[model samples]
Target: MYVVKSPLPDADLKTVADALQGALVDLVDLALVAKQVHWNVVGPRFRSVHLQLDEVVDSARTHSDTVAERASALGVSPDGRAATVAAGSGISSAPAGWVKDSDAVGALADALGAVITRMRQRIASTAEPDPVSQDIFIAVTADLEKHHWMFQAENA
Candidate 1:
Protein backbone atom coordinates (compact mmCIF):
# COMPACT_ATOMS: atom_id res chain seq x y z
CA MET A 1 0.00 0.00 0.00
CA TYR A 2 1.27 3.48 -0.76
CA VAL A 3 1.30 5.85 2.20
CA VAL A 4 2.96 8.87 0.62
CA LYS A 5 2.59 9.93 -2.97
CA SER A 6 5.58 11.03 -5.07
CA PRO A 7 5.50 14.30 -6.97
CA LEU A 8 7.48 12.92 -9.90
CA PRO A 9 6.02 10.52 -12.41
CA ASP A 10 6.48 6.80 -11.65
CA ALA A 11 9.41 6.38 -14.04
CA ASP A 12 11.20 9.45 -12.71
CA LEU A 13 10.48 8.45 -9.12
CA LYS A 14 12.02 5.05 -9.74
CA THR A 15 15.26 6.54 -10.96
CA VAL A 16 15.47 9.11 -8.17
CA ALA A 17 14.57 6.53 -5.52
CA ASP A 18 17.20 4.15 -6.79
CA ALA A 19 19.81 6.88 -6.70
CA LEU A 20 18.85 7.93 -3.17
CA GLN A 21 18.86 4.36 -1.89
CA GLY A 22 22.27 3.70 -3.39
CA ALA A 23 23.60 6.87 -1.74
CA LEU A 24 22.21 5.86 1.64
CA VAL A 25 23.90 2.47 1.40
CA ASP A 26 27.26 3.91 0.47
CA LEU A 27 27.15 6.64 3.11
CA VAL A 28 26.22 4.20 5.88
CA ASP A 29 29.00 1.85 4.90
CA LEU A 30 31.44 4.72 4.67
CA ALA A 31 30.73 5.75 8.26
CA LEU A 32 31.17 2.19 9.50
CA VAL A 33 34.45 1.78 7.66
CA ALA A 34 35.80 5.05 9.03
CA LYS A 35 34.91 4.12 12.58
CA GLN A 36 36.52 0.72 12.23
CA VAL A 37 39.68 2.27 10.92
CA HIS A 38 39.68 4.92 13.64
CA TRP A 39 39.61 2.19 16.25
CA ASN A 40 42.38 0.09 14.74
CA VAL A 41 44.72 2.59 13.17
CA VAL A 42 48.31 2.54 14.44
CA GLY A 43 51.67 4.13 13.77
CA PRO A 44 53.39 7.52 13.59
CA ARG A 45 50.43 9.37 12.14
CA PHE A 46 47.93 7.73 14.44
CA ARG A 47 46.70 10.92 16.08
CA SER A 48 46.10 12.77 12.84
CA VAL A 49 44.63 9.83 11.00
CA HIS A 50 42.36 8.89 13.88
CA LEU A 51 41.00 12.43 14.08
CA GLN A 52 40.50 12.56 10.34
CA LEU A 53 38.62 9.29 10.39
CA ASP A 54 36.17 10.77 12.87
CA GLU A 55 35.51 13.62 10.49
CA VAL A 56 34.68 11.15 7.75
CA VAL A 57 32.33 9.22 10.03
CA ASP A 58 30.55 12.41 11.00
CA SER A 59 30.18 13.62 7.43
CA ALA A 60 28.96 10.24 6.20
CA ARG A 61 26.37 10.00 8.95
CA THR A 62 25.13 13.56 8.43
CA HIS A 63 24.87 13.19 4.69
CA SER A 64 23.25 9.78 4.97
CA ASP A 65 20.46 11.32 7.01
CA THR A 66 19.98 14.05 4.43
CA VAL A 67 19.78 11.49 1.65
CA ALA A 68 17.31 9.35 3.60
CA GLU A 69 15.10 12.35 4.37
CA ARG A 70 15.15 13.36 0.74
CA ALA A 71 14.07 9.86 -0.23
CA SER A 72 11.26 9.95 2.31
CA ALA A 73 10.13 13.30 0.96
CA LEU A 74 10.01 11.71 -2.49
CA GLY A 75 7.82 8.90 -1.15
CA VAL A 76 10.62 6.35 -1.21
CA SER A 77 11.77 4.35 1.77
CA PRO A 78 15.48 4.54 2.40
CA ASP A 79 17.23 1.30 3.39
CA GLY A 80 20.48 1.57 5.26
CA ARG A 81 20.40 -1.72 7.09
CA ALA A 82 23.69 -3.57 7.52
CA ALA A 83 22.61 -6.30 5.14
CA THR A 84 21.59 -3.76 2.53
CA VAL A 85 24.81 -1.81 2.91
CA ALA A 86 26.99 -4.90 2.87
CA ALA A 87 25.35 -6.13 -0.26
CA GLY A 88 25.12 -2.85 -2.19
CA SER A 89 27.75 -0.40 -0.92
CA GLY A 90 30.32 0.86 -3.39
CA ILE A 91 32.99 0.90 -0.65
CA SER A 92 35.35 -2.03 -0.17
CA SER A 93 35.72 -4.09 3.00
CA ALA A 94 38.03 -2.89 5.75
CA PRO A 95 40.84 -4.96 7.20
CA ALA A 96 39.89 -7.18 10.14
CA GLY A 97 42.25 -5.50 12.62
CA TRP A 98 45.26 -3.31 13.33
CA VAL A 99 45.38 -1.25 10.18
CA LYS A 100 48.48 0.89 9.68
CA ASP A 101 47.85 4.65 9.65
CA SER A 102 48.93 4.91 6.03
CA ASP A 103 46.74 2.02 5.01
CA ALA A 104 43.79 3.55 6.84
CA VAL A 105 44.32 6.79 4.97
CA GLY A 106 44.50 4.98 1.67
CA ALA A 107 41.45 2.91 2.46
CA LEU A 108 39.33 5.92 3.37
CA ALA A 109 40.55 7.81 0.34
CA ASP A 110 39.46 4.90 -1.80
CA ALA A 111 36.14 4.71 -0.01
CA LEU A 112 35.42 8.40 -0.53
CA GLY A 113 36.43 8.08 -4.16
CA ALA A 114 34.06 5.20 -4.69
CA VAL A 115 31.13 7.05 -3.12
CA ILE A 116 31.91 10.27 -4.97
CA THR A 117 32.04 8.48 -8.32
CA ARG A 118 28.62 6.91 -7.84
CA MET A 119 27.25 10.19 -6.48
CA ARG A 120 28.37 11.93 -9.64
CA GLN A 121 26.47 9.39 -11.67
CA ARG A 122 23.41 9.95 -9.54
CA ILE A 123 23.74 13.69 -10.00
CA ALA A 124 23.74 13.31 -13.76
CA SER A 125 20.85 10.86 -13.78
CA THR A 126 18.67 12.91 -11.44
CA ALA A 127 19.22 16.27 -13.13
CA GLU A 128 16.33 15.77 -15.52
CA PRO A 129 14.08 13.61 -13.35
CA ASP A 130 14.54 15.29 -9.97
CA PRO A 131 16.71 18.35 -9.68
CA VAL A 132 16.20 18.51 -5.94
CA SER A 133 17.70 15.10 -5.39
CA GLN A 134 20.37 15.95 -7.90
CA ASP A 135 21.30 18.95 -5.80
CA ILE A 136 21.70 16.73 -2.75
CA PHE A 137 23.88 14.36 -4.73
CA ILE A 138 26.07 17.24 -5.85
CA ALA A 139 26.52 18.55 -2.31
CA VAL A 140 27.34 15.08 -1.03
CA THR A 141 29.84 14.50 -3.79
CA ALA A 142 31.55 17.79 -3.00
CA ASP A 143 31.88 16.95 0.68
CA LEU A 144 33.22 13.47 0.03
CA GLU A 145 35.68 14.81 -2.50
CA LYS A 146 37.14 17.14 0.13
CA HIS A 147 37.82 14.18 2.43
CA HIS A 148 39.22 12.21 -0.47
CA TRP A 149 41.61 15.03 -1.29
CA MET A 150 42.74 15.32 2.32
CA PHE A 151 43.38 11.58 2.60
CA GLN A 152 45.28 11.52 -0.66
CA ALA A 153 47.36 14.42 0.61
CA GLU A 154 48.09 12.44 3.76
CA ASN A 155 49.79 9.84 1.62
CA ALA A 156 51.66 12.43 -0.45
Candidate 2:
Protein backbone atom coordinates (compact mmCIF):
# COMPACT_ATOMS: atom_id res chain seq x y z
CA MET A 1 0.00 0.00 0.00
CA TYR A 2 1.16 3.53 -0.72
CA VAL A 3 1.29 6.36 1.82
CA VAL A 4 -1.36 8.64 0.46
CA LYS A 5 -3.98 9.65 3.00
CA SER A 6 -7.62 9.39 1.96
CA PRO A 7 -10.56 10.60 4.05
CA LEU A 8 -11.80 7.03 4.14
CA PRO A 9 -10.19 5.18 7.02
CA ASP A 10 -7.20 2.98 6.20
CA ALA A 11 -9.23 -0.10 7.14
CA ASP A 12 -12.13 0.89 4.91
CA LEU A 13 -9.75 1.71 2.09
CA LYS A 14 -8.11 -1.65 2.50
CA THR A 15 -11.47 -3.43 2.31
CA VAL A 16 -12.58 -1.41 -0.70
CA ALA A 17 -9.23 -1.81 -2.40
CA ASP A 18 -9.35 -5.57 -1.95
CA ALA A 19 -12.84 -5.71 -3.44
CA LEU A 20 -11.81 -3.47 -6.33
CA GLN A 21 -8.73 -5.61 -6.96
CA GLY A 22 -10.97 -8.67 -7.36
CA ALA A 23 -13.19 -6.73 -9.74
CA LEU A 24 -10.07 -5.62 -11.63
CA VAL A 25 -9.04 -9.22 -12.11
CA ASP A 26 -12.43 -10.05 -13.56
CA LEU A 27 -12.39 -7.01 -15.87
CA VAL A 28 -8.92 -7.82 -17.20
CA ASP A 29 -9.87 -11.39 -17.89
CA LEU A 30 -13.15 -10.27 -19.47
CA ALA A 31 -11.27 -8.00 -21.87
CA LEU A 32 -9.00 -10.83 -22.98
CA VAL A 33 -11.88 -13.27 -23.40
CA ALA A 34 -13.93 -10.73 -25.35
CA LYS A 35 -11.04 -10.23 -27.75
CA GLN A 36 -10.58 -13.96 -28.07
CA VAL A 37 -14.23 -14.36 -29.03
CA HIS A 38 -13.95 -11.44 -31.41
CA TRP A 39 -11.03 -12.98 -33.22
CA ASN A 40 -12.42 -16.49 -33.41
CA VAL A 41 -16.16 -16.12 -33.97
CA VAL A 42 -17.38 -17.73 -37.17
CA GLY A 43 -20.68 -18.09 -39.03
CA PRO A 44 -23.12 -15.97 -41.02
CA ARG A 45 -23.02 -13.39 -38.24
CA PHE A 46 -19.23 -13.38 -38.09
CA ARG A 47 -18.71 -9.80 -39.13
CA SER A 48 -21.44 -8.44 -36.90
CA VAL A 49 -20.39 -10.44 -33.85
CA HIS A 50 -16.77 -9.58 -34.55
CA LEU A 51 -17.54 -5.87 -34.64
CA GLN A 52 -19.69 -6.07 -31.53
CA LEU A 53 -16.98 -7.95 -29.71
CA ASP A 54 -14.65 -5.05 -30.37
CA GLU A 55 -17.06 -2.77 -28.57
CA VAL A 56 -17.28 -5.24 -25.69
CA VAL A 57 -13.51 -5.41 -25.54
CA ASP A 58 -13.29 -1.65 -25.44
CA SER A 59 -15.79 -1.45 -22.58
CA ALA A 60 -14.05 -4.15 -20.57
CA ARG A 61 -10.69 -2.46 -21.00
CA THR A 62 -12.12 0.85 -19.96
CA HIS A 63 -13.71 -0.63 -16.84
CA SER A 64 -10.53 -2.47 -15.98
CA ASP A 65 -8.51 0.73 -16.20
CA THR A 66 -10.95 2.65 -14.06
CA VAL A 67 -11.08 -0.05 -11.38
CA ALA A 68 -7.31 -0.34 -11.27
CA GLU A 69 -6.78 3.41 -11.20
CA ARG A 70 -9.32 3.77 -8.40
CA ALA A 71 -7.56 1.14 -6.34
CA SER A 72 -4.22 2.82 -6.92
CA ALA A 73 -5.62 6.20 -5.97
CA LEU A 74 -6.59 4.70 -2.61
CA GLY A 75 -2.97 3.78 -1.87
CA VAL A 76 -3.22 0.06 -2.67
CA SER A 77 -1.27 -1.76 -5.36
CA PRO A 78 -3.86 -3.49 -7.59
CA ASP A 79 -2.84 -6.89 -8.91
CA GLY A 80 -3.91 -6.81 -12.52
CA ARG A 81 -1.10 -8.67 -14.22
CA ALA A 82 -2.22 -11.28 -16.77
CA ALA A 83 -1.05 -14.09 -14.54
CA THR A 84 -3.03 -12.76 -11.63
CA VAL A 85 -6.15 -12.35 -13.74
CA ALA A 86 -5.81 -15.81 -15.19
CA ALA A 87 -5.45 -17.30 -11.74
CA GLY A 88 -7.88 -15.20 -9.75
CA SER A 89 -10.69 -14.01 -11.98
CA GLY A 90 -14.17 -15.18 -11.02
CA ILE A 91 -15.34 -15.20 -14.66
CA SER A 92 -15.58 -18.56 -16.33
CA SER A 93 -12.84 -19.84 -18.63
CA ALA A 94 -13.53 -19.28 -22.31
CA PRO A 95 -12.98 -22.13 -24.73
CA ALA A 96 -9.46 -22.53 -26.06
CA GLY A 97 -10.35 -22.89 -29.77
CA TRP A 98 -12.53 -21.08 -32.28
CA VAL A 99 -16.24 -20.80 -31.49
CA LYS A 100 -19.35 -20.33 -33.57
CA ASP A 101 -21.07 -16.95 -33.54
CA SER A 102 -24.02 -18.02 -31.40
CA ASP A 103 -21.79 -19.95 -29.04
CA ALA A 104 -19.45 -17.01 -28.65
CA VAL A 105 -22.32 -14.64 -28.05
CA GLY A 106 -23.83 -16.87 -25.39
CA ALA A 107 -20.47 -17.36 -23.73
CA LEU A 108 -19.71 -13.68 -23.65
CA ALA A 109 -23.14 -12.85 -22.31
CA ASP A 110 -22.81 -15.46 -19.60
CA ALA A 111 -19.39 -14.13 -18.65
CA LEU A 112 -20.61 -10.57 -18.50
CA GLY A 113 -23.58 -11.66 -16.43
CA ALA A 114 -21.26 -13.35 -13.98
CA VAL A 115 -19.20 -10.20 -13.61
CA ILE A 116 -22.31 -8.11 -13.14
CA THR A 117 -23.56 -10.41 -10.39
CA ARG A 118 -20.28 -10.23 -8.52
CA MET A 119 -20.04 -6.52 -9.14
CA ARG A 120 -23.47 -5.92 -7.65
CA GLN A 121 -22.45 -7.80 -4.54
CA ARG A 122 -19.28 -5.78 -4.32
CA ILE A 123 -21.28 -2.61 -4.78
CA ALA A 124 -23.73 -3.46 -2.01
CA SER A 125 -20.90 -4.45 0.28
CA THR A 126 -19.60 -0.88 0.18
CA ALA A 127 -22.92 0.74 1.14
CA GLU A 128 -21.78 1.72 4.61
CA PRO A 129 -18.01 1.48 4.67
CA ASP A 130 -17.41 3.25 1.35
CA PRO A 131 -20.28 4.69 -0.58
CA VAL A 132 -17.88 6.26 -3.10
CA SER A 133 -16.45 2.89 -3.99
CA GLN A 134 -19.99 1.58 -4.23
CA ASP A 135 -20.73 4.38 -6.66
CA ILE A 136 -17.82 3.32 -8.84
CA PHE A 137 -19.08 -0.25 -8.86
CA ILE A 138 -22.57 0.95 -9.74
CA ALA A 139 -21.26 2.90 -12.72
CA VAL A 140 -19.22 -0.02 -13.96
CA THR A 141 -22.15 -2.38 -13.43
CA ALA A 142 -24.49 -0.21 -15.48
CA ASP A 143 -22.13 -0.25 -18.44
CA LEU A 144 -21.53 -3.97 -18.12
CA GLU A 145 -25.26 -4.66 -17.92
CA LYS A 146 -25.77 -2.79 -21.16
CA HIS A 147 -23.08 -4.85 -22.84
CA HIS A 148 -24.58 -8.01 -21.41
CA TRP A 149 -27.93 -7.08 -22.88
CA MET A 150 -26.36 -6.47 -26.26
CA PHE A 151 -24.58 -9.79 -26.14
CA GLN A 152 -27.83 -11.52 -25.18
CA ALA A 153 -29.56 -9.84 -28.09
CA GLU A 154 -26.97 -11.37 -30.35
CA ASN A 155 -28.24 -14.78 -29.24
CA ALA A 156 -31.93 -13.96 -29.67
Candidate 3:
Protein backbone atom coordinates (compact mmCIF):
# COMPACT_ATOMS: atom_id res chain seq x y z
CA MET A 1 0.00 0.00 0.00
CA TYR A 2 3.00 2.28 0.17
CA VAL A 3 3.10 4.87 -2.55
CA VAL A 4 6.58 6.22 -1.85
CA LYS A 5 9.58 4.09 -0.98
CA SER A 6 10.71 3.85 2.63
CA PRO A 7 13.39 6.22 3.87
CA LEU A 8 16.87 5.30 5.11
CA PRO A 9 17.81 4.55 8.73
CA ASP A 10 16.12 6.47 11.50
CA ALA A 11 19.45 8.21 11.99
CA ASP A 12 20.96 11.48 10.89
CA LEU A 13 20.92 10.46 7.24
CA LYS A 14 17.19 9.97 7.34
CA THR A 15 16.68 13.21 9.20
CA VAL A 16 18.77 15.11 6.68
CA ALA A 17 16.99 13.38 3.80
CA ASP A 18 13.58 14.25 5.17
CA ALA A 19 14.67 17.81 5.71
CA LEU A 20 16.13 17.89 2.22
CA GLN A 21 12.82 16.81 0.79
CA GLY A 22 11.08 19.61 2.64
CA ALA A 23 13.69 22.04 1.37
CA LEU A 24 13.14 20.74 -2.15
CA VAL A 25 9.46 21.49 -1.91
CA ASP A 26 10.10 25.00 -0.75
CA LEU A 27 12.65 25.56 -3.49
CA VAL A 28 10.32 24.32 -6.20
CA ASP A 29 7.54 26.58 -5.02
CA LEU A 30 9.87 29.53 -4.80
CA ALA A 31 11.26 28.83 -8.26
CA LEU A 32 7.83 28.77 -9.80
CA VAL A 33 6.83 31.96 -8.06
CA ALA A 34 10.01 33.65 -9.23
CA LYS A 35 9.35 32.70 -12.83
CA GLN A 36 5.75 33.82 -12.52
CA VAL A 37 6.89 37.20 -11.33
CA HIS A 38 9.63 37.37 -13.91
CA TRP A 39 7.20 36.85 -16.76
CA ASN A 40 4.46 39.08 -15.44
CA VAL A 41 6.44 41.95 -14.01
CA VAL A 42 5.91 45.40 -15.49
CA GLY A 43 6.75 49.05 -14.75
CA PRO A 44 9.89 51.16 -15.09
CA ARG A 45 12.30 48.67 -13.53
CA PHE A 46 10.77 45.78 -15.43
CA ARG A 47 13.95 44.71 -17.22
CA SER A 48 16.11 44.75 -14.11
CA VAL A 49 13.59 43.06 -11.83
CA HIS A 50 12.70 40.47 -14.44
CA LEU A 51 16.37 39.62 -14.93
CA GLN A 52 16.86 39.31 -11.20
CA LEU A 53 13.84 37.06 -10.88
CA ASP A 54 15.25 34.84 -13.61
CA GLU A 55 18.50 34.53 -11.72
CA VAL A 56 16.67 33.68 -8.50
CA VAL A 57 14.53 31.09 -10.22
CA ASP A 58 17.57 29.49 -11.80
CA SER A 59 19.31 29.24 -8.45
CA ALA A 60 16.22 27.80 -6.80
CA ARG A 61 15.91 25.21 -9.54
CA THR A 62 19.53 24.19 -9.08
CA HIS A 63 19.01 23.90 -5.34
CA SER A 64 15.91 21.80 -5.90
CA ASP A 65 17.90 19.31 -7.95
CA THR A 66 20.62 19.12 -5.33
CA VAL A 67 18.13 18.56 -2.52
CA ALA A 68 16.21 15.91 -4.45
CA GLU A 69 19.40 14.12 -5.31
CA ARG A 70 20.39 14.15 -1.66
CA ALA A 71 17.03 12.68 -0.72
CA SER A 72 17.49 9.91 -3.27
CA ALA A 73 20.96 9.17 -1.93
CA LEU A 74 19.39 8.57 1.45
CA GLY A 75 17.11 5.85 0.03
CA VAL A 76 14.03 7.99 -0.36
CA SER A 77 12.08 8.83 -3.47
CA PRO A 78 12.06 12.55 -4.13
CA ASP A 79 8.59 14.08 -4.09
CA GLY A 80 8.67 16.51 -6.97
CA ARG A 81 4.97 16.67 -7.70
CA ALA A 82 3.41 20.11 -7.47
CA ALA A 83 0.64 19.07 -5.11
CA THR A 84 3.03 17.29 -2.81
CA VAL A 85 5.44 20.22 -2.83
CA ALA A 86 2.70 22.75 -2.23
CA ALA A 87 1.41 20.73 0.72
CA GLY A 88 4.88 20.29 2.23
CA SER A 89 6.31 23.76 1.69
CA GLY A 90 6.16 26.42 4.41
CA ILE A 91 6.47 29.23 1.87
CA SER A 92 3.43 31.41 1.32
CA SER A 93 1.42 31.07 -1.89
CA ALA A 94 1.76 33.73 -4.52
CA PRO A 95 -1.24 35.93 -5.25
CA ALA A 96 -3.04 35.79 -8.59
CA GLY A 97 -2.74 38.30 -11.43
CA TRP A 98 0.11 40.60 -12.21
CA VAL A 99 2.02 41.77 -9.16
CA LYS A 100 4.28 44.75 -8.62
CA ASP A 101 8.01 44.00 -9.18
CA SER A 102 8.83 45.12 -5.66
CA ASP A 103 6.12 42.96 -4.14
CA ALA A 104 7.26 39.91 -6.08
CA VAL A 105 10.86 40.43 -5.03
CA GLY A 106 9.79 40.88 -1.42
CA ALA A 107 7.69 37.73 -1.45
CA LEU A 108 10.51 35.64 -2.96
CA ALA A 109 13.06 37.01 -0.52
CA ASP A 110 10.81 36.24 2.45
CA ALA A 111 10.22 32.70 1.25
CA LEU A 112 13.95 32.12 0.67
CA GLY A 113 14.77 33.38 4.16
CA ALA A 114 12.15 31.15 5.72
CA VAL A 115 13.42 28.09 3.88
CA ILE A 116 17.04 28.84 4.82
CA THR A 117 16.03 29.19 8.47
CA ARG A 118 14.18 25.90 8.38
CA MET A 119 17.17 24.19 6.77
CA ARG A 120 19.45 25.62 9.44
CA GLN A 121 17.21 24.27 12.18
CA ARG A 122 17.08 20.82 10.62
CA ILE A 123 20.83 20.74 10.06
CA ALA A 124 21.32 21.60 13.74
CA SER A 125 18.92 18.86 14.84
CA THR A 126 20.81 16.05 13.14
CA ALA A 127 22.00 13.45 15.62
CA GLU A 128 24.79 11.61 13.88
CA PRO A 129 25.41 14.60 11.62
CA ASP A 130 26.15 14.48 7.90
CA PRO A 131 28.72 16.80 6.38
CA VAL A 132 26.74 16.91 3.14
CA SER A 133 23.74 18.34 4.87
CA GLN A 134 25.85 20.91 6.62
CA ASP A 135 27.52 21.84 3.35
CA ILE A 136 24.24 22.15 1.52
CA PHE A 137 22.71 24.28 4.24
CA ILE A 138 25.70 26.56 4.32
CA ALA A 139 25.70 27.03 0.56
CA VAL A 140 21.96 27.53 0.33
CA THR A 141 21.96 29.93 3.27
CA ALA A 142 24.62 32.08 1.64
CA ASP A 143 22.69 32.14 -1.64
CA LEU A 144 19.44 33.05 0.11
CA GLU A 145 21.14 35.80 2.08
CA LYS A 146 22.60 37.25 -1.10
CA HIS A 147 19.19 37.22 -2.77
CA HIS A 148 17.62 38.87 0.25
CA TRP A 149 20.23 41.62 0.19
CA MET A 150 19.81 42.14 -3.52
CA PHE A 151 16.04 42.44 -3.16
CA GLN A 152 16.42 44.85 -0.27
CA ALA A 153 18.94 46.93 -2.19
CA GLU A 154 16.43 47.39 -4.97
CA ASN A 155 14.26 49.28 -2.52
CA ALA A 156 17.10 51.59 -1.53
Q: Could you give candidate 3's per-residue lDDT for residues 26-110 as a string of tens digits?
A: 8898898788778788777889999999888989999889888777766677888989987988887775788787787777777
Instruction: For model 1, give the 10-residue run with minimal summed lDDT.
Output: 1-10
**Superposed Cα deviation of residue 53, candidate 3 (Å):** 0.3
lDDT of 2 by residue, 16-96 (tens): 977899899999989999898888889999999899889988988898888888877777788888898988888888877
> Candidate 1: which pairs clash?
none
TM-score for predicted model 1 compared with the true structure = 0.98
User: Which pairs in model 3 have colliding backbones?
Assistant: none
**Which order, best to worst by lDDT?**
1, 2, 3
* Tens-digit lDDT string for candidate 1 (1-156): 447898899999999999999999999999999999999999999999999999999999999999999999888888988899999999889888899999999999998999999999999999999999999999999999999999999999
Estimate TM-scores for all models: 0.98, 0.95, 0.87
Cα RMSD (angstroms) for every candidate in the order listed: 0.6, 1.2, 2.9
- The local distance difference test score of each candidate is 0.94, 0.88, 0.78
Give the lDDT of residue 33 in candidate 2: 90
